[model samples]
Target: MSEEDVVQYLQNTPGFFERNPALLEELTIPHPVHGGAISLLERQVSLLRKSTAEYRGEFERLVSIARENEAIMKKSRRLILKCLSGDSLDDFAGVVEEVMREDFAVNYMSMVLFTEQPLDTSVRMASWESAEPIIKEMLAQSGCYCGVLSVAESEFLFQSQSDSVMSSAIMPLVSFEGGQVVYHGVLALGSNRLNHFDKEKGSLFLDYLSDLLSALLLRLLP
Candidate 1:
């Protein structure tokens, strides 16, 4: 009989193995690693061992990821607490900048609010009247954007530090009250290393930070 016919016969008649149990001992195949022949039972054991090893490696990787996410969450909680402790926009900005420099490990970071708010104008912000078209475009996309920044975009966000920065992540900050945009702002991050930010980077943490910033900024409103 052909190999396919033998396989089909074996599958069609499961009782054959029980009836002819002695045939199992007779069955032998060339070993994959060793030069000698091995029984079918040994081959099956080898396959099981390989599968178990693969599963173990996957479990270890998952554990590592869990630990990393936990660490990141701890840092995020600290940042949120710091943001909430500030009484004014200037205080809030200081906390954000200091935490980002000390904790987030960013080369440079800044905030820009596009609306007239009751804060010191010297606190690194531009009102809606002063916002350029590029800023509007950034808000139009309306999410965390990570990658290399163009010359115009970098200049607009970083200004004096534009030439020093090689990569950037831009997150639009908007607080909504009943679907209406109340506070429009931008959080700009810069890095001297070209590969610091990539397009494929996950947005979960960035989104969380933006939400926290937006919530804290809501206190500025009337």
Candidate 2:
């Protein structure tokens, strides 16, 4: 193939010698010297085409992955908007669970809200007895709130003692008006899989969640 033909072919290929001008120079070498009679132009063209095809495949695969990630992110953002507009706490909780399940692929979920200072010694928030210790510890530690994602070992230990949760993320809700504290509560989340609530995974979503819960708590106070 002629040098001009080779250059045009390379340019037409999706990912050919776009990076190197030197390759074009070698192909355009006007006079052939030495023993090799035929110009190695056709050989270079074949290699370039093969490399271009592989790169095009890789680029396409990356594009597919990016598109999938974008769709998931959009769905997650929509779920957050839905949570913000929910009419009631029950509605909010439902949306929260749905978002976790559908967007984060979380398998288990729960929430706990703190009560007034006199404390609602009357009842427990979760039906699971195993959670009582964690709740008690949180209360005693002056921890406004906490969320935990149990490691595989912790999950086994928890289950051995009682029904255990795999992963969790907790946040505290403190309600105040005119500098007077009205209520404090913890919001909890759980997932049945490992590393589901890692810091890097859902930090933005969790921050939004904390803000939503804090606003709701503030509204609940007199």
Candidate 3:
């Protein structure tokens, strides 16, 4: 029977009145059968109420987790800002390493600042050898602002890296002053699992990291 018809049947069934003595006395119609069907209908209603309660509980837990995560990110961003205020590049690197471990749970992370002249063609930037072209392309494309990129799964750049490394998140750090975009750097992260970074995941923390790095670079730049 259709669900609506079944509901109508359950509500009006004579057997329900017979099974439930309390209900039978209240009803005007006389019920021939004692309480069997009424008992089953009461059980169904109880189960529905229980299932709804469980779903609501789960939703509340999810919201709590999201808020906790947000608080963690805010603390991490504050630490990054403190790092940016340092006078030396070495101090910044140390802070970046610490932040990556605490915030992203990633083992390998690097911050590479670009120069007008190529440093060395042999040394791959941020440990990704084949990504030289990709990096060059991105710098050319974006002109001079902070941007985010996800590496392709099949890309050889990631596959050839250490076995512990599975994925990377690349964000360009840009310094803008008086409507002029001056310095650019890259923040790279390496994780052991392919699913570590993806579009589905929120990148709010990463955006904050990029801003902090950009501010540091602007201060350090000549």
Which candidate ranks first by lDDT, i.e. highest?
1
Q: Global lDDT of each model?
A: 0.80, 0.56, 0.60
Residues 23-63 of candidate 2 have per-residue lDDT tens digits of 65565432333435343475566578889999999999999
Give the C-alpha lDDT of model 1.
Answer: 0.80
lDDT of 3 by residue, 163-204 (tens): 556656766677777997543557667776767776467566
Q: Is 1 or 3 the stronger prediction by TM-score?
A: 1
The alpha-carbon deviation from the true structure for residue 36 of candidate 1, after best TM-score superposition, in angstroms, is 7.0
RMSD of each: 2.8, 10.3, 8.2
- TM-score of structure candidate 2: 0.45
Give the runs in model 2 whose Cα sits over 4 Å from its true position: 1-65, 102-104, 117-164, 169-187, 199-205, 212-222
Residues 6-28, model 1: lDDT tens digits: 99999999899899988888899
Residue pairs with backbone atoms closer than 3 Å in model 1 (clashes): none
Q: Could you tell me how far off, in angstroms, the CA of residue 110 lies in candidate 3 after the best superposition?
A: 1.6
- Estimate the TM-score for candidate 3: 0.59
